[model samples]
Target: MTGASPLRPDEAALREAIVHTAREMERLGINQGTSGNVSARCADGLLITPSGVPATALHEDAIVWLPLDVAADAPVLSERKPSSEWRMHRDILRARPELNAVVHTHSVAATAMAIHSRDIPAHHYMVAVAGGNSIRCAPYATFGSQALSDYAVAALQERYACLLAHHGVIAASATLSRALWIANEVEVLAKQYLLASQLGTPPLLSDDEMAEVLEKFRNYGMRGTSGNGAH
Candidate 1:
């Protein structure tokens, strides 16, 4: 997901991207087993990983498609069940019209921070990569619940990623690769923050400093990349 290149847009290609990303997340150690899910915006809806399926067992045809307009509780027509987090993904893409992909992970360090309900503050200027001075942690809610989806959408306001209290991390972006990249970056930041806290509290960048960083980030990092797929 780290800016290798933009993916091709055809449904066939996007399906492959979903499978590739799911496995890559596991391979990169950001996710394990069936704990994480991936999705991409497609015509009128989204293509998502299937529920209860490990990335190692996932295949392109196992991917599920759901219309964005459907209620989270509604039955889906696909042969396979979409990820339990489909509601969160659907709400995010619907709310953030510009974002085309979503990656959810139970990465160890990030979820460790989330278990404490801590936000990732601007302990590093790279915090701006998430489109904010901090990565907010949404209040705890049962997985797959509509309440959880609501909190996640609000926490992600003006940001590409957020942590779920007692749950995991969610990273969304304009493309599948960028979403995967942001998901990885969130884990890195969380790990650094935890390491720094061992010294009795990490120094934080001032709001003014973070503002400057955010300004510089507007024309840099993942946002600066340009390509044809998932603009």
Candidate 2:
């Protein structure tokens, strides 16, 4: 038998954050249908949106909690089935203790580039906000498969965000809001990259230039910083 466990107490706010992020994706045009999912780490496991549930209709209690230490073959610990992409969220949360949340979406421009299996190079300094010189596209795999999860994890090794070739995007951070914000930035960068490509191969930053920006990111980007989110 698999090693799934039970939920813990007072995770009400995390449930709300997941629900809000799901719907926010819709509002922000980062996703459509129920094609995206969000999750936040909790005391016992992680809280995720229910499978196939529309974000507008999502309610806090409908969220599913999967214990961190659970074995893969175990029945899910909650009544509702979790998102099909739960494995990536689960793996990401397990692998990255510094990140408390994960946001995945089939955001338009990003997905368009991913359809070509192209990575977003450092055409703009804002790419550093993802903690990298470029956003790599994890090689394609069937959605919801363990292979896809593995590919995403590897692509995001030193970065908080990455695209899934022909699939979508993934962003994670210390907080749900920050994760969502980064997802939006990735989408904007994707849009920019796509637009610039129409003219010619876009100019890209040198590794040294991107390194300078990555350093700026640690002290910038987040709202409370002196640069006021400029990095």
Candidate 3:
């Protein structure tokens, strides 16, 4: 069911955060117009950005509350419709309880790489922060379709970020800011990868080395709160 109730104090704050994040994405230049969406987990559902709304026009009340258990294609009851990618956000939050926020972007570089269906390997050690040595690209599926949501869930199985083939990027984390950070980082990585390709194949970190980095990230904290290794 789409939750249309008045927001509780905490829910209100969460809704505001989602609106802020949706705008932040635009300011960061990782998203444009209304091509991306942001959401934060709330009481039995998620507060997602409204469909087709530009960031400048977004507001707390415009956020749509979608229950985690509702069917992906179920008719929404809210005054505003949730983003078309709401199912992807909902499924990820349901499958990864540790993650509370999800950011989906059509960032240029990342989408360029996604259009080619490429994975971002551990060419830089920082890739470990995403919980793996590589950010996989989920095979393409039509936007708003269940198949796309299924593909996203599978690609994010052991990673917090993934590229949707021919589409864009998905970055999810324990907090909205952290998820946004990952989204930006993925775009940076994609840009760097494309630039480095000019010098032939870029040297990649070995699996053993990536494993060590992953361990270190785990110990130092994958979340940005620690401020140790996280960006």
Which 10-residue window of candidate 3 scores lowest in summed lDDT? Answer: 222-231
Per-model TM against the reference: 0.91, 0.92, 0.94
Model 1 RMSD in angstroms: 5.6
- Poorest 10 consecutive residues of model 1 by lDDT? 222-231
Error of 2 at 44 (Å): 2.8
Kindly indicate the candidate among 1 and 2 with the higher TM-score: 2
After best superposition, candidate 2 residue 45: deviation in angstroms? 0.6
Which candidate number would show the highest TM-score if scored against the true structure? 3
* Model 3 Cα lDDT, one tens digit per residue, 84-189: 8888988999999988999999999999999999999888888776779999999999998889999999999989899999999999998898898899989988
The residue pairs found clashing in candidate 3 are none
Candidate 2, residues 1-231, lDDT tens digits: the string is 222224455577678778889889999999889898999888858888879988888899888878877556657634558888889999999998888899999999999999999989999998987778899999999998899999999998988899999999999888888888889989999999989989999999999998887776665644221232672
Indicate the residue-level lDDT of 170 in model 2. Answer: 98
Candidate 2: Cα lDDT at 73: 67
C-alpha root-mean-square deviation, each candidate? 5.6, 2.8, 1.8
The Cα error of candidate 1 at residue 162, in Å, is: 0.2
